[model samples]
Each structure stands twice: as structure tokens, then as C-alpha cells.
Target chain A: MTNLPLSVPVAPNRLSLSKFARRSPSAAIGAALVVLILLVALFAPWIAPYDPIAQDIANRLMPPSAAHWFGTDSFGRDLLSRLIYGTRPTLMLLAIVILLTTPVGIAIGIVAGFYGGMVERILMRITDIAMAFPKLVLALAFVAVLGAGLVNGALALALTAWPAYARQTRSETVSLRKSDYLAAAEMMGITGPRLLFGHVLPLVLPGAIVRMALDLGGIILIAAGLGFLGLGVRPPTPEWGAMVADGTQVIFDQWWVAATPGAAILLTSFAFNLLSDGLRDLMDPRNG
Target chain B: MSLVDISDLNVTFRDQDVGRHILRGITVAIEEGETFGLLGPSGCGKSTLLRVIAGLNRDWHGSMSLLGEAVAPRRRFTGKLRRQVQMVFQDPYASLHPRHRIGRALREPLVVNGLDNPDKRVTEALAEVGFGPDVASRYPHQLSGGQRQRIAIARALLLRPKLLLLDEPTSALDMSVQAEILNLLVTLKARFGMSFVLVSHDPDVIGHMCDRAARMAEGRIAATFDRPALAAGAAAAR
Candidate 1:
């Protein structure tokens, strides 16, 4: 018998941060912007020039001055400080929603895809019903029932967010179920959860993560919308959507009031979008 | 007793309203420690029959027995039957999981079966396929087609299965690599004393590897060749 070659060249196991940045500049920029926002949120108290909620009637409506950088709102609160504090709730809500939805959605999807037939029909139909309703309307209905607090708002958004993940994961799992590796695993007597979670779940994760990143921007927009409608965090607590609502009243005279928080929301969503696009490109099977 | 026995095996796939008959009444018996070849052209259901024997395709009409135990249609092979039969697929590139390392893939079957000393078993299996210990750390994408096929062979043999079903195992590799893999299979089969049901379109491969071979056309065994006939290249003629 001919001997197989001993020395075969191997691809690098890890992609360094610098290499990743060089490969996809937009993702790098997005990551940097996200890190900056996280830092701002983390050190809001230390970084803010004045207390976010503390009103200084004398400084009310101040515009782009040396003392009040982003100017003061109608409540005479610092717009910059309020924006800084606002980042906290938005990020917190996102984390909560992701934690709640990813596992539930993936589980429902894998079970449906793996079992197929009647289980697939029932689970997918339920996912479809959940998906059929307008996301904002369903979230609004949920908030109306649950009452508006940070966790409740997060819960409402999470309920609407999971169906899309379920659909994405289910479709991926359906195709993966036919793959040769999975079939080989089955032949070895690896069945049930061990096969599904061990063999199937890892293959489906990259796509699901890319989907999650893409969904982040949309989740932020919906969260901000809830805050604008007075169904978010209780009053006097800084929220980007509430701040924009606060800005709209004096938009004609003082555009900075609404503009500052509006700019923050736009930048945050844009960062997530760029990050997701880069991730999708990197994780593409063709690229691998 | 025969290692594998099947009589009148038929497989039909139903899509919506139409039922397509893929395997139409195939009967074959493989003696213990024998290499039986199923030689046929594309779309002749050789791979389907291999899948049936491996228990990967359970939806079939047949009276089948493996190592003397009968198997029912549309039922999963359980316990010893499940572990005794293993299959290596056609494409080397697609057979192994892309994300998993070679070591993990080899250890998986042993781990699943609750066998002890998985690491040692993985090392031994790799060595049996002419691979060194360092090869274990590499991913499937890193390996060449020949290397991947060897790894696939090692994984199937890790369970010490009684019957190994090969679905065009070397068809994906080039000329030189195919010979190496086929030789490797010959040596491994001799060492393990295992029966193999090899499916291929090439008559040369069948004559080289199989002790008793069947030439299939349109899902039926058109001719069966003994050692003398195969040596005379009777399979290639008709």
C-alpha cells in the first residue's frame, strides 16, 4: 500500500483583530463606534457635565454653548447627559431581548426542522401566525397589557423578535438535515438531542449570529418607538425616543433638542447594520 | 451464516401524488469477511441499496437480515444492529463536518457508543489509515481529497463495525489517490476481517476489490461474477 503524505499545509486557526479590520474596514469602524457608545453608557455619570435629570431653569433652551454642549431641553436637563444615560436602557433592552429570543427561537426551529412533518407544520404555523402581525403593533399590544417598564418593554419586543429567528434557523436546519455529515452521525447511532444539538446546532450558529446582528438595528428602532409613545421607561428617566419626543415640541426654535438624541439613534442603528453586513460576508460558506 | 442477507428489496419515493420507484426488487447475500461489489452506471440505485443496508434509508419494502437478525421496513436499527453497520459516503469533501477537527470527528462514534479510551482509539484509527497524530488537529478544509477520504474511512472503522457500506468512496478522488485509497481499504478489511458492500460505476475497481461482484442495470442484478470471471474482466465486457 502507498503511504499517505505526512506534511500537509494547514490554514491558520484564528483570525486576529488587525487581520479582521484589514479584511473588512466597515465592520472595524462599526465595532469601534459600538465600543465608544458602550463606554459612554458605562461611564455616563462620570462623563456627563451635569446630572441628566437635574433641571437648571436658568440654563433651559441654551444652544451649542461652551457650558452646555448639546444644549438644554424643555426640562432644562442636559441633552448630552440625557443621551449618555439613554444608551444604557437601549443596550440593556437589546441584551435582554437577545438572551430571551435566541435559545427559544433556535430550539423551536431545530425541533421543527429535525422532526419535520406534523411537528414542523404546527411549530412553523405558530411562528407564521406570530410573524403575520405588524411587529410594532404586536409590541404595542404587549406593552399595553404588561405596562411600560424597562423589562416589560424588552419583553414586548422580544415576543415580536423571535419569530424571524425561528424562520431563519428552521430553514437552515431543514437543509442541514440532508447533509452527509448529519446522515453519517445518524448511522453511528447518534440520535435525539445529542445529534441535533451537537452536530446540527453548531452548523446553524454562524447564520443565526449574522441574522442576530442584522436584527439589532431593527430592534433598536422599535425600542425607540416604544419610548416615544410614552410606553417605555417611567418619566424623568432618560430614553432616546422620549428625548426626541421632548425635542419635537421646540423643534422649530431649537432643533438641537430633538436632533441630538435623533442623531444617536441613527448612528447606533447604522453601526449595527455595518457590523452585520461585514459578518455576513465573513461567515459566507463561499468565503470559507 | 451470511453477514448480510436481503430478498426483494424495493424503495419508492412519494412526492405529492407521484410515486417514483428507485430500487426495484434487489436480492443479494454477502458471506462473512467477504467484499461484495455492486457495479452499475449512474442512476441505477446502487447507492440507494448501500444506504438501505446501512439503515440510513429505512423506508423500504424488504425482508432483510444482518449477521442473522431480521430487520423490518420503516423501523430504525437499534442497539447492536445500529453499531454493527456503518457507511462512508461518496463525497470526501462533504462527508466530514466542516467545523469539526479530525480528532473530534473520529472520537464521536466511540463517545456516542460509550466506548472507553476515545483518544487512544482515535489515534489508532488514524494510524490504521496511515495518518500521524498531528493530523488530528487539522480541519476538513485543510485536508486534500485523498486525506479526507482516509479520515472518513478511519471514522467508519472506529466503531469496529462488522459491515462497512462504501458508496463510491474513491470516486471523488483522482486516479493516483483512488488507487491509494482502494489499497488502504484492502489492507484495513483484511486486518479487521469485516464484510464490505462496495458500490461503484467502475468495473476495474470492482474486479480489484470485490471477491464476488454483481453487475446491475436499471435497479436489477443483470450478472453476477465469480473470482475467475472478474479476473477475466467479464464485468467490463457486458
Candidate 2:
């Protein structure tokens, strides 16, 4: 009876908003705020008060003054504007990596699950081999190979992150392939890549979304980690991670200098993590 | 020409560690607009028989054809051939991909078949299945079992298929829902002149919807009864 995919459904009285509210008020608020922040980041050029990169030594370390709000960094750049502009590249990389890896991973997983044969073994083995290496270690290797830049960093993130998406997708797909609809699609001559992409891909997207939830935080952390290590969006660049990295040099006297960008990164990533959890509950098909 | 022809059909499976024979030899056929029931108890290879004919199960040795053309196990029916054949799965839940909205599921066959005006076909399919325009936008998980089964039916209809292979289409549904679906199938056939080859464990359901019912055991048909004669019990239920 449980294998019956369509048996249980959302009770007519249950609204999606109510279920979302039941899940987490903090997540809803945080998700909204984060989305707005991203929107602001996406339009930073018009929204930001000053160019994030322009240096003003006189304004440097101004300590939260209104003219150079959030205060100027030691390098005389606006921390708030830099942080605002910083959100875009990190979010962009996070989105780009997930976009690159998620579909490919999902495709591989669905095919392996749907057509459990040599293809499954090969794909799993390949994913396993890739996964065996520590993701960060692989990212480091890729960063080294691609030579420290934004798109390259995103590519590095994609290479390692894809394996997890593949593994998760494969297991989910294997279970789903046993479902009658998948077989029905095949029975209708909708087998091979068509069934994998058309049918199973949609099913796995939720799982991919869940993974992206988890990955978003990790990607930000990784980008920040790389930026902190001086491999991210190049120095004097308005990267939040790199900003925090630069701030730590003056942490004892200027606690706000280091703490502000760090807190921003922490809060934005935390919001995505919580939102992922809320989405997991809300998106459960049985819940609907 | 006969709409379906199967000869020397055999399906085998491995017991995880050891390969085992799941289906012996099953052979059956149906002409255009005819309803053929494959009735059997659970684990009697009835589903395997249907899958073989539907081109889903490859671990088989059989010759199956549609409309006088020979079918290659690997050569899936494409274009017109694909549109000519369709299937409704056993479990209403598992048969419809959960992530797909009702519209995508309904429009899938149309898209795969390269049909023009998929939107119109999707709307028509929903309406034909007793669903409204709103149902199309909702995901599979959003619909009730009866409602989901209706969508599955709507999906099958969107292809404008000449033949349909149904595997216990209503076994997972409540009796009331089953009756409603059965009635829908009956009327659709009458309206479209589509042939059916249905596999079911429920003899009563088979008798109610199919024009002919063949009992299968051990992967082979044991007895067959014409649809009109079995009305003694099924008629009262109907």
C-alpha cells in the first residue's frame, strides 16, 4: 500500500502556507530576508552608496560612521558596500555550481537507478572514485589547477559536490524506478534518456534542492575558506570572506571590522540551511 | 490486422544472487477494439506478461508485435508506434511520478510523441477523466488516490493510443473508486474504440471491465471466460 505512489494526499483543509508556518517562522522570515539581500546584491551597482573597491585612506577605520557606513575597512573600502557586492559572487558561485552539478548528478543517478546494469555500476564506481577524495581536498586541487578565480572556483566546487548529488540521487532514483509510473512510462516506450530526464529528473529535483540547501552553506563556506586562504576572488576585491580574512589582522582593536562581514556570511548561510530544513518538511509529497 | 501478437514469451529473473525463472512461456493476442483480461493470482507472472508486451521488461525471450510489424527488444516503438501503445500501472501512487504535476504527467506522452497543441490535449485529457482545468497545475502528490488514478488515465488518453496495457489498474484503489474508474474505462473504450490488454488479480474487476477474461497460472493461461457470462457476481457490484 505504501508503494502506491498516489494513495495518500494532502488533506483538503491543509494549505501550503499553514504547513510552511508549522515548519518554522524563523525560516520563513530568514528566507525572505536572505532573498531580499540577494536581490539587493544582484542590483548592488545602483543600490550601494559607494563603489566597493574605491579606497579612501582618510575614511579607513572610521568606526561605523554614517558617511562610510559599517565603517571603512583597514584598506579604506566600505565594508557594507563590499559585503553587499560580496553576496552576488558567492551566491552566484553557489548557484552556478549547484546548477552545473545538480542536473548532471541527477541525470546520472536516474539512469543508474532506472537502468540497473553496467551503466549503474560504472556510474556508481566513477562517482565513488570521485567521492573517495575529500571534497575540499579535490576543490583545492581544482583551484590549484584552474588557478584561483571565481568561475574556476565554481568549477572546483561543482566537480566535488556533484558526487554527493549523484549518490543521493542514485539511491532515491533506484527506489523510484521500482514505482509503477516509471515502469508505466517505459511501458509506453518512454525508456532510456527520455524517461530518465523527463520523468525521474523532476522527481529527484526535490532531493537536489535539499542537497543544494546543504550545499549552499558549504559552497559559501568553501568560497570563504578559499578567500580566507587567498585563493578566492583576488585581493582588494570586495569579497565578504576575504574582507573577514583582512579584518582578522586587526581583530584585537577593531573587533567590529572582522566580526561584521563574518556575521553576515554566517547569517546568510544559516538562513539557507534552515530554509532547506523547512523546505524538506514542506516539500514532502506525503505531506501534500 | 491484429493489434497485438505475442509468441514464445518468457521472462526470467535473478534471485539477487541466483538467476531464476519468473515467467515460463506466455502467449496471447487481441484484435482491434477488443478487451483482453489476463486474470491470475499474485506472483503468477501476469504482470511479467504485461511488461513483456509493453516493452519494459528486457530479461525475456519473446516475440511481440503491434499491427503486423515485428518488434525488436531493443528497438522501442517511436513516433507513431509509440503513440499507438500506452500503459496504466497497478498502483495509482507509484504509477504517476510524484514530482510531476498532473499537467506534466498528462502531457508527457503528447510531448514524447511530438504531438502539436499539447496544452489543448492536456486540457481535453483532464476533462475526459472527470477532472477540471485546475487539476492540471497540481503535482501528483497533491491529488487524491482516486484523483491521481484519474490523472494517470488522463495521461494514457493524451497519447491517443490504439492499444493500452493495464496492470491491475484498480487493485490499489477503494472499491468505490475502482467502480468509478472502471466505468470511466468502459465509456472511454466505447467512445474511442481502443483495444485493451489488462492484467489483474481480481477476477471480479476483470469480469466487470473486460470483454474476455483469461485465467493465468504459472505464467500460462489456465482458463478463459467471455465477459458477458461472468456477470452473475460482478453485475450486482456494478
Candidate 3:
């Protein structure tokens, strides 16, 4: 009876109906809100009527008029337009930083994990040391050494960000290395590269993606903080942090000048954080 | 001729927390068309010995050969011979990746060994293990324990391995399901002319499935039974 045949149905999505349903109306609404924000950002040029940089010194601090919605800044720039325009470049920066860090971090983590012994010990120790310092402080040090610019800040953020993913993914890989199919794959004449990419990579990707989504919110915060400290976009640029910092001097007199761009930063990142929370709920096994 | 030859195999595990011996210089063999059982109690290093024969555990000190090619510990494996040897794990839930569909799980092995018709092979393999064509579209979690074990067996058989290492294939299932799978393995073996190295502590499995049985006391083989008389001793075990 060497070649007996059997029939079975494979379960779908590795989750039950109750688990999938955990992505409630509230989560979808959160996602929709995020999509709306991104859409507004994507069409900022078409949507906002006034020029973000076109300063009307005479109309400055006019306090939310019909024509000048969100009031005029100390520089007489339209706060609404600056915020809308400000989103484009920062979003672009976040996307690029994520793209670069994810692969680098995952690769390094996988290598250190799959090939244990001295190599694992050394790489993990370095990652631990890097992780001990705060992420913002590390980015700050790198940006200081690398010099201030939007790209430099993005690069610095990526440098610090890769280690977070590297450490998390390294732990994930360590657990995955012992999985039986991986061992079976190895015994079936599968090369290290083939086993690593085909088997181990696919297994860890969902977790990495979930982590990346969470990191997206963090990236926004870091970039804005850098901009606030003047290590982000140079003075007078339409960055949210730069605008907020520039408006701080006149904040005591005109509160919206400081608070408006600050509000924009809060709301945009809040949407992402909520989305991350939703994803964590969905992907986690315990929630279902 | 022996499909697999293992001699004086000793595997060890050392971590920061604990260091212990796993396989204490165990040896076993499987001839073509034979079902040999490494019948033992729990935590007896049956799986570890199978891993040594499969060339997955490089930390072991051993001499092993699959189809006449020698395996050196802590070195590169010979692809052709390695492909001729495969293993089936005890737990299907832990063995199969949650994300992959049945087809992907089956296709991966064939692809890794440089075969193109992985889907066709997957279908054929699934059929060989009693799964119908439609089962290929599903994932692991949807299947029962017996069904998952069949899939695991199908995956091992896809390569048409000479010596199949079945590490407690049916222990995780109920009695009825275990019988179904054992019948499947027996049917598959006679049909395909393949050999087996079945590791289990179950008396019925050792009695019904294997041509020869070895009781592994600690890690060394204490006795080998050529017929069903030891089947009496095996029955007394439960």
C-alpha cells in the first residue's frame, strides 16, 4: 500500500471567521479615514486654492476668516495650504525610508538567525547595543554627523529603524529555524539560499509587514521631531515640524499659528497608529 | 543493498541554559522495500537519530551513507543523495507553515530540487497520500490531524525518497485516524517500492507496520525483533 491516496481540505487564511471579523467597522472606518487623509495629501496642489508660501504680511494673524481658512501664520502664509503641501514631501520621505530599511533589516536578521553559532552571537550583541540607546538619540547623532537635509534625516531614520526590525526579525527567524518543513526542505537537497528565501522568508514576512506598518507611524514621528529640532528640512521649508517651530515664537500671541500645524501632525500620525493597532489585533493569534 | 547506513551516531545539544546528550551513539539501517521501526518511549532521541540520518543535525558525531554516498558532519550535503532521503515530522500543525496553501507547500520541495512540474507532482503526491485534487487548493489548518499527516507523508514521498524517516507520524492522531494513515503508508510503500524508518512508541504501529523492530533503551538498541513475537512484548508496553 505504498501509494495510497487521501483527500483533505486546507483551511483558508490561517484564521477563523471570528478572527477575520475582529477587523470591525471601527477598523475599516479608521482605514477609510487614513485613505482620505492620504488622498487629500496626494491632491494638495489641486485642492488648496492659496499658495502655501505666498505670504500676505498685511493679512497675517487674521483669525480664521472666510477667505483665509485656518488663519494666516506670522509670516502671513496660509496655514492650511502649508500643512497640505507639507504632507507630500514627508510622506515621500517615510515611504523611501521604510523601503530601504525593511529589506536590509530582514536580510541581516535572517542571516544572523538561520546561521547560529559565533555569527549569530556577534550580530545579535551589536543589535542589542544599538537598541539600548533611544531611537531618536541615535538618529540625532547620525544626522549631526551626516549633516542636516531631508534626505539625510531619512537616511538617519532608516539607519536607526533597520535595527528595530533586525532585532525583531532575528528573534522571529530563530523560532522559525526549527520548523519541520524547513528541516524537511533542508534534507530534500534544498540549498541554504533556496531554503532561506523560499521557506523561511515567506514565513516571517507577515510579521515583518505588521511590524513595518507600526514603524510607519514611528517614522512620521521621528521625521517631524527632526524637523522640529532644525535637523529636518531647513528653515522656511513647508515641513510640519519646521512650520510648528517657526510659529512657536508668535504662539503666545496667536495660538493657531503654533497649534494648527501641530494639530495636522497629531491627526495624520494618529490615523496610522490606529491602523497599526487594528492590524496588530487582526494578525495576532490571541485576539481571535 | 541498504538504502541508508548509519553507524555510531552521537548527537549533543549545548545551550547557555542547559547542556545534555540527545542521541548516544545510535545506529540503524533500512533496506529497499523494508519498513524498519525505531520503537521507543518518549524523549528517547528517536527524532534526533532520524535527523542525523537526514544530515540536518550537523552537531552530531556520526558515520552515515544514503545510497552509498558518505555524509561528513558539519559539511555540505550531496544534493542527489540528500534528495533521495527525506523525513516526516510528528506534528503537522507545527511542521507546515500557516501562510502557504497546500499547493505551495507541495510545490516548494520540487522547486528546491530544480524540478519544473511541481504542481503536477504535488497533485500526484497528494493523491498518493489519499488526498483528492481539490485538497491542493486548501491550507493546513482546514485539514484534520490525519489529513495533515497524509500531507506530510505526501510531501516526503514527492521526492520519491529511498529511505523515508517517519518520526511518530500517527502518534498525534486518534486510534482510527492512526490506522487509516498506517494503512496509507503501507499501501504507498508496497506500491512505490520505497523503504521506511518509522519511529514510534506505539505497539500496534511497530507490530503492524514494520518488518523488523528495535527497542531503543536510552539511545542504544537493546534488542531487535525480526517477527511478531516481540509484537507480544510491544503489546504489553501499552
Q: Candidate 2, which segments miss by more than 4 Å at Cα?
A: A1-23, A39-85, A138-147, A189-194, B1-8, B27-34, B62-67, B72-75, B78-81, B99-104, B114-144, B157-162, B207-212, B225-238
How would you class the docking of model 3?
medium
TM-scores for all candidates: the values are 0.98, 0.81, 0.91
Residue A171 displacement in candidate 3 (angstroms) = 0.8
Per-residue lDDT tens digits of candidate 3, residues A214-255? 888778888889888988877666888888888888888888
Residue A53 Cα positional deviation in candidate 1, in Å, after optimal superposition: 0.9
Candidate 1 reference-contact recovery: 0.72
Superposed model 3: Cα runs more than 4 Å off: A1-22, A125-147, A285-288, B15-19, B231-238
Ranking by TM-score: 1, 3, 2
Provide the global lDDT of candidate 1 against the true structure.
0.89
TM-score of chain B of 3: 0.91
- What are the clashing pairs of model 2? A4-B93, A5-B93, A5-B94, A6-B93, A10-A288, A181-B95
List DockQ, one per candidate, in order: 0.72, 0.32, 0.57
The C-alpha interface RMSD of every prediction is 1.7, 7.7, 3.5
* Model 1 per-residue lDDT at A206: 84
